[model samples]
Target: MTLTVRALRAGVPEDAEAFARTRRATIPYLVCTAEALAWEAAHAPAGQRLHRLLATGPDGTVAGCADTGLLAGSTAPGHGFLHTAVPPGQAGRGAGAALVAAGEAYLAGLGVRRVHSWVADEDGARRFAERLGYRRSRQARFLGLDLRHAPLPELPATLPAGVTLASVADFADDLRPLYEADVECAADEPGDVDVGATPYEVWLRLNWGRPDWDAGLSGVVLVDGRVAAYSVAQTDGVDRYWSGMTGTRRAFRGRGLATLAKLAALRRARAAGYVHAYTGNDATNAPMLAVNRRLGYRVVASEWRHLKAL
Candidate 1:
């Protein structure tokens, strides 16, 4: 039962795939792929101290994995994040503990004084976080929709006046407008962490450059030539698809623009052969939750944001 926890060797395809496998086993609601994992490791913003760790058993099998780092966009000092995943049967083997210890030590060395982690809202997960001195802060639900079974909304035959639906690829030449809209929407997203205005360069690298980001599947709503609402889509290039982010600018909130944008994105995803669609939202986001519920997205899992002061 001997185990070793060490930093993941970036650029090594095998290690990246193993790490992705562990994540998928532990958190299936979120999308994970070897290419996406490698991209995050290699393209993380310069200010964010990214550390990917792997827990390996004596047989060289990956028992668990962790992604930890400081929130580079946070204006508040000492804010850090650590998310660890250990498949069900591997929990008692000390893999979780080893990863947590290593992750905390790594962040602490980088001057992080407070760390945050998201633990699935289950008995064992809560107990583990409590034992590690983390306290619950907020909750978020993971929702899933079976594109092959559930009925989706039909696209309106006529477009609303001054409104047009388009794919993200249409803006390939210039994404500034989309970025501006995203920054505004992100600031209003419910969460314990305040990721203040995200810089265009950082957003471009981490989000726009993501391997799973399918521009054709991403939908945007423009009002009189201005971006009003948009949905970012991510896929595993298989059957799994994820709504990376769906939001509407404050000025267009109550017009159902967000819902329209998401519906368009989901339809595109289904047409593209993606069978499973998933998204996550904070429990306090009633509007978004209602929108997902109406779209037949059922709650599959929930996680509690846990905070620990170092």
Candidate 2:
């Protein structure tokens, strides 16, 4: 079984399908679609040196896919993120390793200083990264809420005096404020990343325009008509819901707005026929973790962010 990597060009239907397939196979717990795949490949910033590649079987079926690129917003230039994945049944066919090799080489040519990738909380994946010289850095978890079985929390009857809950769609014409709030909230997230300087245009394209993002289902807590906290929801157009992000602006902390927004989002998700809701948080994000625990989310799996100086 000879495995080879090929570039996934924009506007190519097969490439988009392959990306969707590979993502589904490797990470069925999260949301993924062809539209999202195409959007990422087409809209990546020009300076990022982004490229998506697919590994093909001898019969031309997609075996896996990999995305390699420089972290556009990194203060440390030459930092890259390499995410390569093979479908569950296709592992050990050499597709994953080939894709990783291709991705690392691609980043190396672009002068990338380090490469980081996400590894699942499984023995095989952990071993794979360790053998490839990647060292685990931060641990993150994916939580699942059985919306049909898990009891949903009730919304708070009163806000923090002037705070209130609202739908994100109310600000469809002006998402800049939400973006600003997200940046501020994200800076406090525990991670190996410093995402405080996210660009508005980039966020607009990569996040706001994502195919799975449903503004109508997303909830925001507004204080005096300003966004205080929000929970963004993403669905795969089926029974699965993924939490895109949930955060509170710095000043709104301790008001429990974040919990309120998440509860609203989860209720909406259940009404939309989503039986399962998925969310991930850094191991060190105690406040958010506590919020999720209160909403009946249980840890389903964990992933480690692995880094290697290439």
TM-score per model over all chains? 0.98, 0.95
lDDT of 1 by residue, 1-310 (tens): 8899989997899999999999999999889999998888888887888999999998898999999999888879999999999999898889999999999999999999999899999998999899989999999999999999889989789989999999899999989999999999999999787778877887887788888999999999999999999999999999999999999999988988888899999999999999999999999999999889878899999999999999
Cα lDDT tens digits, model 2, 1-310, are 8987898878988778879878878887789888887777777778787898999988988889988898887766778999988888888899888999999999999998889899998999999889989999999999999999988977767656777788889998989999999888877778675544777887888887877899999999899988999999999888989989999998878978889999999999899899989999999889999999999999999999999998
RMSD of 2: 1.5
lDDT scores for all predictions?
A: 0.93, 0.88
Q: Which ten residues in a row have the lowest lDDT in candidate 2?
A: 189-198
Q: Pick the candidate with the highest TM-score.
A: 1
Candidate 2, lDDT over the whole model: 0.88
Candidate 1 lowest-lDDT run of ten: 193-202
